[model samples]
Target chain A: MIATKRRLPLPLAALSTGFVLLWVFVAAFPFIWTVWGSFKVEQDFFSRDSWWFAIEGTRTIAQTGSAFTGDGYYGAWVLRDFFSSVVNTVIVTVSVVVVSLTFGTLGGYALARSGYRYTFWLLMLALVFRAMPHITLVSGYLLPFFEMNIWGYMPTAIIVLVAINQPFTLWMLHSFFLSIPKDLDESAMVDGCSRFQAFRLVVIPVMWPGVITTGLFSFLLAYNDFAVTAMLLSQPNQTMVPKIASFLGTIQQEGNVMFAVAAVVSATAPLFVLVLFFQRQIVSGLTAGAVKG
Target chain B: MPHRAFFAFIMPSLVAMLLFIALPIISVAVQSFYVQHERVVTEVETCTPFAGCTKETRVDAEATEKLRNEEPLGRFNGFGTYLDRNHLAVSEIGAILSDNAGFKDAAARIYNLPFYRALAFTLTYTFVVTPFAMLLGFCIALGVDAIPPFYKGPVIFFSLLPMIVTPLVGALIVYWMASSQGILGATLQTLLNDPTLSLKSSAAMTWITLLVYGIWHNAPFSFVVFYAGLQTVPHDTLESAMIDGANRWERIRFVVIPHLMPLATFVGLVQLMDNFRVFEPIVGFSAEANATSLSWSIFNDLRGQVDQLFGSAAATSMLTIVGVIILLSPVLVRTWRDFNRR
Candidate 1:
């Protein structure tokens, strides 16, 4: 039986349930509709006469007796060669995660353990950088990169993304390390190991969960980034998000709107799967700050 | 860790941050004081009797290239770009103030300046979106809390969809739906009984759509935070309040919200910083005509293929940093105090 004091009346409960379901519909419907629409002809999917025409079939598709097509996916994947962008995105994201986590773990652990005034200042400084928009740094990099002739390379972008990811990485990892007791490493040190040895053997094993959570965020940041990748990388070196943006640029002139639609769906699919699998880590990562703050 | 170990651990991050993050800021600040210029050499061609030609001046490309190589930083013009119409618009403001114009007229004149125009929308976006997202998020948290436990995970997962997707992709999803040919757009047009009314057609509608998208994209974050906060609200206090005849609204107003205030602040601080950038959505919406932001202005200046306005973009970036510092100072001050206390 429900607790009499806590449970609301049936009418009120029903009303709230209805509202919640409505909101869920609002939140999830667009992606579902778009995914379905991606497989249909543009006219049928965006039919003027009825919103259900895509489900029912478009004029051209109906006359031809077909309800679905793959032109969007074909044009995007085969014709546009978007797979290279997928490769670029994976390379950048992986490099950013690996490089950033290495620095973040060492630096954040040091910050958490150190009692010096500089540690506080360094963390605070990272906060300032954290708040800075990446576009600002892109402008600063342009002239120098042009002079050095390294403006449009994937490695340069990956390095920049890693640097940009560092502040948040350090902050989160710093907080996460603070939760682990210092005595574990100290005991290891007392037992005849150097500080680095103690950290490698004692602290690192327990730090994996936090590091994994932090790494997930770093990966997301690098993967989802648009401004830095869009501005910094040249045409051939463009990542997936920027490539999708490039599609938007020529979408009108080339009549490849469906290509963009297909690309958007494809780009979102990984994130959906990531959220499903790593939902716990993502949630914990989000709330970690909330609880600490 | 000991001092040597600490230094060893921090050195790589310090170097990276110095080279990439700190140096860029200094570079931008320096660049803001300088303008890029094409080196021009004026040469006089004297008419000769044999040639029987008029004297003419011509550009010297080699000399230009040499000068550019020698002084790549360009000529120093300290605060000139910042004070110009593209940025602070100090002179334009002075003119408007001297005229003693009405508020609306002065605003119109000021909005003509690119910097102030972007500032206006950026500020509007920051102030409006933060509060609205918080309020809507709180409501959603409450609504979701009212339901049974089995439904929570799926509801939260779907809610996460809007925020977890890339900002540009998420904004495009909403933007495409709000286009005239899409279902919601078509339905809204029909419901309004006007075939021609389109979200793409109006400035006010565009701003509203962006705000809605902003709230949609961000509210889930606040919801997740607040929902976690909600779970920790003491059942004893709620039960006592109920025994005291406290209704749902009263109990919520007095008990629930107070408990969540700190969490709300966390969400607000994060949202303020995130929303202040506001770059990707504007690009995604292609609402550049109706709306521009500080970040967008920086992007626009740097993106011109043949004409990169480096000085102006740098100055705008400096101003944006200043704006972020100003807007976030209170939080920073509190954080500093808290850190000191700890």
Candidate 2:
């Protein structure tokens, strides 16, 4: 539709094509290179002989008569007990999504259904909190958590993550709830249903897409978090990002840089899958505010 | 909605926000007024006169313990920590002004103070990255829109990868490629014909690399938004402009841009907020030596060895919160007006 219905442009089209290709390369090359490099021995990957070290098999691999190696993934996942980190990440992410979505949906529905002035102020409050740097809360939580003897546990971290995720969750879901028509629930209420019953019977069935999208974001916030998890959870409870960071600090000296590379790819794999599966919802969720505003 | 139903619905979020968000903010503000201190113990040692000896004083463990136990929150300084060198650096500013230095010299002196230096980089990164990302995104959206529909989906999926990936991971992917031993860094070193030349070797180079990364990571968000905006660009208006003999460039300049302004503003506001809180890239790139942000400074203060320095971190957090509030006030005002109008 935006082709202008003209066929006279040659150089411009070429330039556009080049730009798009350049962007694609810029976006895709790093993942491809990293994933490729993670499968090779460090000596061969960083051999300095050619830029094609990743594409072409290394001398060590040829010597061993194997095209690829799992040393990096093995070192990171098995030796480092990355399984615990994965378990911790799942526990925290699931808890955060459930709690954040529950509160967010309830509050968002309230805000959307009500016509009072206070709802506006409440949303404004959420916007302010959403914009504030979350690290600010870490300083506040540290002293209290320390005194309470709960500083380095998973539950405290989960609660904090849920709190931190609330503002954005409420904002996104509030807009989503607003997009749902109130008439459905009102008619349900007219049919002898209470407000809660109406919400359960009428609004929730249609609100799954919004909930899923918001839940996706909440999961990202909890799963991909480094600052909160790193600060709140001590040695035993560290998640993947912080574990990878610790690996980066120590493994480079031990000649195990590939472990970190493999871990990074592992950390990124789920998000990649998330994007693949939910590309439409993610895009719409992102543009929902902009388009509506 | 009835008051009871509304209260029931909003209560959980209100309580969560009150406990986590509101309470912490208040606690941080209060904590900023107090500083943590270690009690120094003093001990006196007596010498015998039979041989030549000297009297010595050592730390008194019991006294120090007693002192710390009495006041666990440390000493109340009432904003002194905020004015200290790690934060506002009030006295240091006085010293710099007294020297009558040049602008660059004064700036360097101020940059020596950690807080101002972080603010400088944060502002520069935010301002520089936001506009450039928007421009690049607009250009890409236009380019993609002009292309045939068959190629758009894959191109978009590839483009979204950068923005959708976990930020630190995205940054690490780029950081690995840009490291001294990696492909780009090696190529740049060879291109310069200096074996020791690396992107991480200099502050200027690292700053540029980070800015490039910022643009590369975030421009796709703008692209997606602008692409969506392009879909709603009013077809009749485009056709009318075309019939009026407006060329492609003129149509874009006069019609398409004006149409996408709101989305651009939305993207700009969101980008500014995101960029101001830049922390992960610094960690991913190990660029702390060359750059620090307010958020990073807070992390640093809290990670101190002997003491957590909660006061200083709180001060920085409050400053960061203030900065965010200031930057977002315009958007808040716009939203308020829109809400009232509705």
Candidate 3:
């Protein structure tokens, strides 16, 4: 009886694992291919050199012939508009992180600790912007921006990027801050910290980790966006996504160019995130915020 | 934070959002009533240079200039944008509104046909991606939580891989992979022994790739969220569940899942919203692809067409946004109570 009982959950766990593995397999190849292909040059790209080989000699020579091992990353990064991609990515990502955090934390804080009756309207307002298809936003804005030169000076891409990144942080960090009891703030105020001081000195320090996690997501999401970059930028000013898309048409085009840069770009934030999340408390905040939502 | 300064701290985001997001919505709304300039520029540089290498040239300017000379730029003709682009006399929009027979037949048609279809597409898309993403996340949470502590960090980080990246990149990656000529295209084709795989059909390609892609991108995020939820499970509830001889699934389903109901609901609802407006991937898939949803089609009318019709596209978008708000109401109502309580 016990054996039969234990077996029931086994299949569920296994099924879940199978699902995870299937997704992982699907997710891994393009990423790995991106890394490998980035090393090969144009001649190799056209030769269908993207096709993998191991232990074979002649084809590998032809494939590896034009591949410059030493400077590929540097070429993609500092030389071949990669530096600009990094700059654009950084500018957009950093601004998004700061702005989204402010909105999310404050919005979430209001949602969490307020007696304000209109908070529902505010929350739903967030959902409206969050839920709307970004393409619709892109489509609607293009004509107006073209007609009205006021927004012309500012890069339209950065503006949309912020809008897109805002909802998630609001959702994630709202729960994070809300979970902290109102009494905690009340007590901080009682201890003579002004409400602002209580938030800054008391509550903020406690929720700093949650803030970091949300900020990390905002920065990363802004950096890697394709459609925004593709639509917003001119070719010379392309961020990583448009750059990747240009490299993306076919195996006939340079597929490896995307793969290599993606590998590098995707790897950047996760490294810092992993380091920051080493402590269990912060790591769990992400799950808590997401799960509770 | 004091209420006043706290409000002040939040003002920057609010202002940025208002200018970029809110005003754009208003601008689009206003512009929707006016016709878009139909200038066919002969020699604008292609932003994506790789897609073009031919000498620059032009033709359509003749028609636009003639039209402009006859009438001032941005002149509006009533309700034409909604129907003309589809090349359908009474598109599904007209068919739906025709039932009303109360409003002008044209107004009825525009709202009923295109508006409903756009709403359906957005709702279906969001509903499809959200819960499953949550499930995938919760499973990851279970796995990482079960593991020895050191392994959690690496696994969690990797799982979050998609979450950390932009949604646009996620779509691009999937588009590249699912294409017949992409990196894994050959592999999948080889596995099937057919020159064509599922990518041959546009909608099928979207569903398969988008679903899998959504999971791949979201599982780690969901895991992190669910894991955090798991941490907050009061010990008393767990002890009680164990004492009752409740299995882990029973504990999770009864005790744990209930606690996450608010969360699961929110994530599910949000994902529903995200998916409903699922324009980028379809657009990314290409013009040749037949899987264009109502949103993508409406957008094409405004921006992606031989003729740009700004008014009707904006109207349709407004209608679509309204539908999403309706869908969000139940969750917003509940969250409101929490926001108000002492």
Candidate 4:
């Protein structure tokens, strides 16, 4: 039902196709280059003599007797103990997704179902909370957490992330709940089920799609977080993004920028897969706010 | 839902936001009024057999620790930290203004102040990136809409990569490619035949690069939203515009854009909020030498080498929050009006 009843003039069509292709190249090239470059030795990937050396892997061949090498990955995942960070990241993201979704769905459902003025105020407050820079919030947390002796623990980071994640999650899930026909729960409520029971019996089963979409975002927030994770989590409890950041500090001097490159690629792999599998949901989730507003 | 049920459902989330989000602002406000405790000192005299006694003053470490332990919030200075050079620099700005220097010189001097410098970059970045990203995304959405359906999915998947990836990693990828030894840097040098033309070599170049990165990072979001909005545009409106002898551009100008206006506002608001908190790119690009943001300045304070400047960080946080409120007030007022209308 696009307004393509009349074809674009030839020149305009060509120009648009060219523009789209150019955008595709711009969007995709860096990752493609970086991923390919990550497998090569530093000398080749960052070849001073010729860019072709990156593709040919000349230095890599010379150093490791192959056109490709896993040295960067090995150095990062093993020698630098990036594995522990991966474990930490898994723990953080999972816990954040679970806890935030639990709280978000409950709050979002209430906000969607209620016909009160204060609900609007609550959401407005959330909008303000959402706008608070994560670093600003971290600044507030640091002194108190340090004083409470909860400064450098995984649980503290997890809880802080849940709170930080709450605003956006609530907004998304609130909109999602609005899209769900309220009568589904209201009818169940009229049949003698309590609100919570109606929510569990009727809404919970159909809520998974929205829940999963919100969970993807929550997972992303926890996984991609640098400010809170970098500051709040102590060295051993550091997540992947912070660990990658920490890698840049220690490894650059050792001429192991490739380790950082490799880690970046590793860090991005899951997100790539997430988009691959959940592109539609991701798109819907993004447009859900804009379209509704 | 009744009030009790609604409260019960929202209580956990409310408690979390209140404890973590609302209370922190108050804590930051309180902390901003206080500076770290001054080290206690004592005058000491020691006498030996061979020499006359010499009086010495030493930092009383035990006393200082005891004082700090007794009051971890430090001593209240009541806005002193806010006015200090590292923060708002009220006195410094006043001195610069009173100097009667030419506008350029005075402007340069004020820009050299850390807080003003960060604020300038942050605002410049937000204002510059938002519109460009929206425009670029609109173009891409138009292009995608014009493309054949067969390729849309893959094209979208590729497009989403930049936005969906971690911000720090995305910035790192761009930074790596733009670094001196990286491919893009080398190609640009070879193309321009100016070996010294490096993106990181100057402040202007770094700012331009960051603006470009910002556009790149943000455009996909707007593209996705706009594309979705495009799909929902009414066919009848376009047909009627065509029947009215409107050209393709006219149809788009009159029909498509109007349909997408609200979505554009949404994108603009979200982008403003996100761009105002530009921190990751600075860290990822290691651009601290040339550029910083309000968020980055706060991070720098907390990560100070000697000791964490809690008071200074809190002051900056409060100021940043104020800036957010200023930036968001118009939108808030409009939304309130809309809600009231509803």
Consecutive 10-residue window with the lowest summed lDDT within model 1 chain B: B36-45
Q: Which docking category, incorrect, acceptable, medium or high, applies to candidate 2? A: medium
lDDT of 3 by residue, A1-293 (tens): 12222444666657655665555555455555544544544333223334443112234357555333434465556555566666666666677677678777876676667655454565557666676666557656766566565232325676678767776666777777777888998898899987667777778778887887777667666765654566566666666665655544532254344344433444344434543555354455455544565
| Fraction of native Cα contacts reproduced by each candidate | 0.72, 0.68, 0.33, 0.83
Model 2, span A179-252: residue lDDT tens: 88888899999999999999998998999999998898888889778889988899878988888888888999
What's the CA error at residue B53 for candidate 4, in Å? 4.5
Q: Candidate 2, A59: how far from true, in Å?
A: 4.2
lDDT of 1 at B78: 94
Q: Scored by CA lDDT, what does every candidate get?
A: 0.89, 0.86, 0.60, 0.94
TM of each candidate vs. truth: 0.96, 0.97, 0.74, 0.98
Pairs with backbone N, CA or C atoms under 3 Å apart (clashes), candidate 1: none
Q: Report clash pairs, candidate 2.
A: B41-B60
Candidate achieving the largest TM-score: 4
Tell me how far the alpha carbon of residue B256 in candidate 4 is from the true structure, in angstroms, after superposition: 1.1
> How close is each model in CA RMSD to the real structure?
2.2, 1.7, 8.6, 1.4
TM-score of chain A of each: 0.95, 0.95, 0.73, 0.98
lDDT of 3 by residue, B63-156 (tens): 7777765643377755565455332335554455556666666563553444444444455556666777888777766655554455555555
Q: Per-residue CA lDDT of candidate 4, range B150-262, in tens?
A: 99999999999999999999999999999878899899889999999987789998999999999999999999999999999999888888899998889889999999999
